[model samples]
Target: MPLTILTADRDLDDRAADAVPLPHAGADHWRRPYRPGPGRVGAAAVSLLLASFVLLSAVIIVAAGALPAAVICSGVAVLIIALALRFLRVGVWVSAHGLRQVELLRTTTLRWSEVAAVRTVQRPVRWLGLPRTVQGQALVVDRQGGSSLRTLVTDHNGDFLARPEAFERAADVLEAWAAEYRR
Candidate 1:
């Protein structure tokens, strides 16, 4: 109490106290830390356009007094819309539960216990999930017990195509989550 010196640590503490708290992924819910790229948005737009055409044809069929055909067209339009929604949902998601990778036709989830490591590596990644490969970074997940490595997210994927900084931040966040939960 005789002499109290405001050291660097104390100064940092004061600055931190005044700093705005940033939002983080919730402990209980799922979060997608990256933004969807143009490829995904374009696909969704095409899907919606197809759905609209189908719906319009359904209306025309209904006007032509073909009730059954109109109903079938309506159903097909609904299915297309559902597929578009699913396409939009395709990406990497993280939560307390684990990491989830949603593809066009399937979803894979790996628990934190099952994950050995999540790291970013430079490699040839599919360009927007196409056959054309591009030299970029990918976030790969290694499972425990020598299982096959899974590529969770790639800089060329729909979530990060042409966005290197965003990909790096997403990879870092994923690595942090894996590190926190793997312990």
Candidate 2:
């Protein structure tokens, strides 16, 4: 007698179809349409590097029999790592539920129903989220029944810095998503 193994016969699509859909309450439900630029990535990289050094110094301090100093260094390392994570998370995210603008210290979310229009405009936008501004295009979000225009994505932001084509494509995708979901 030959031993045989039995398995369910199903295609990939069938298995995928059977999977339960995830709830739209978190980052998993959102999509980033653009890539982070060198400035943001570089800052995060530098932060991680500093954290590594701090961790190494902590280890050395522990070997040198200074427990208190080692603990402090470890804490600093943890803070640096957190900062790097924050840098990585700063960006614009879109979904059927809404549009999200994530900053270093704040996040703003606008539902599709609240959005009046998402259009590209020629204006001065922050350079890499800096105080200094540069002449560029921005994806402005107009709220329903409001005169204030919220700037969502900018050509000079981390995602589209020095990438004009990517800015255009991302703006179009965001506009399309707004159009489709607003109805």
Candidate 3:
């Protein structure tokens, strides 16, 4: 017997043994993997253009015999690449237990019991401190907390608004699940 086959069999056996039985677990558990939509792709394209511009600037600076300035521009380009990679990894995961928002730097989970309300609200994109783009619908999650009224999901960066219809559909499914499984 090959070691690879032995290792695979052992892994399968381990997973089967570790799996716990649930009373109601099959199709009731909803799952969604957030993928990049047209809006998100466009956003990424703009970032790529900006990065190219930065690289061009660096080349120009180096041609002018300014090694330090070119290094600074290269550093800025690296920072932009890091930030873009982080943004691309942002995702939302929905299950029977809760809705989890996964980002590059942080993850937040809100249980069905914790959620008070899920509603759409108008959000405007701003430029130079003034509203510039058309107002879009933002999915807001109201949750109960101590002190004054608290909220959980704000959709601050317009992730939920990127595809309003799809987002609303997902939100509707989540709301239905919450209603059915509220504890």
Local error of candidate 1 at residue 31 (angstroms): 1.4
- CA lDDT of each prediction against the hidden true structure: 0.83, 0.82, 0.60
Ranked by TM-score from best down, the candidates are 1, 2, 3
Best by TM-score: 1
lDDT of 2: 0.82
Clashing pairs in 1: none
**lDDT accuracy of residue 57 in candidate 1:** 100
Off by over 4 Å in 3: 1-36, 59-65, 89-97, 100-113, 119-138, 146-164, 176-183
Model 3, C-alpha of 101: deviation from truth (Å): 4.7
**Candidate 3 C-alpha lDDT tens digits along 1-183:** 557553313433456658775767553464553334444556767887898899999999999999999999999988877777666656656676876666668877777678766666676533212346555444566676622122222333434443454556555665666666556
Model 2 agreement with the true structure over 41-74: per-residue lDDT tens digits = 8889999999999999999999999999999999
User: Using lDDT as the measure, which candidate wins?
Assistant: 1
How many angstroms is residue 140 displaced in model 3 relative to the true structure, after the best TM-score fit? Answer: 2.9
Clashing pairs in 3: none
> Model 1 segments beyond 4 Å from truth?
1-25
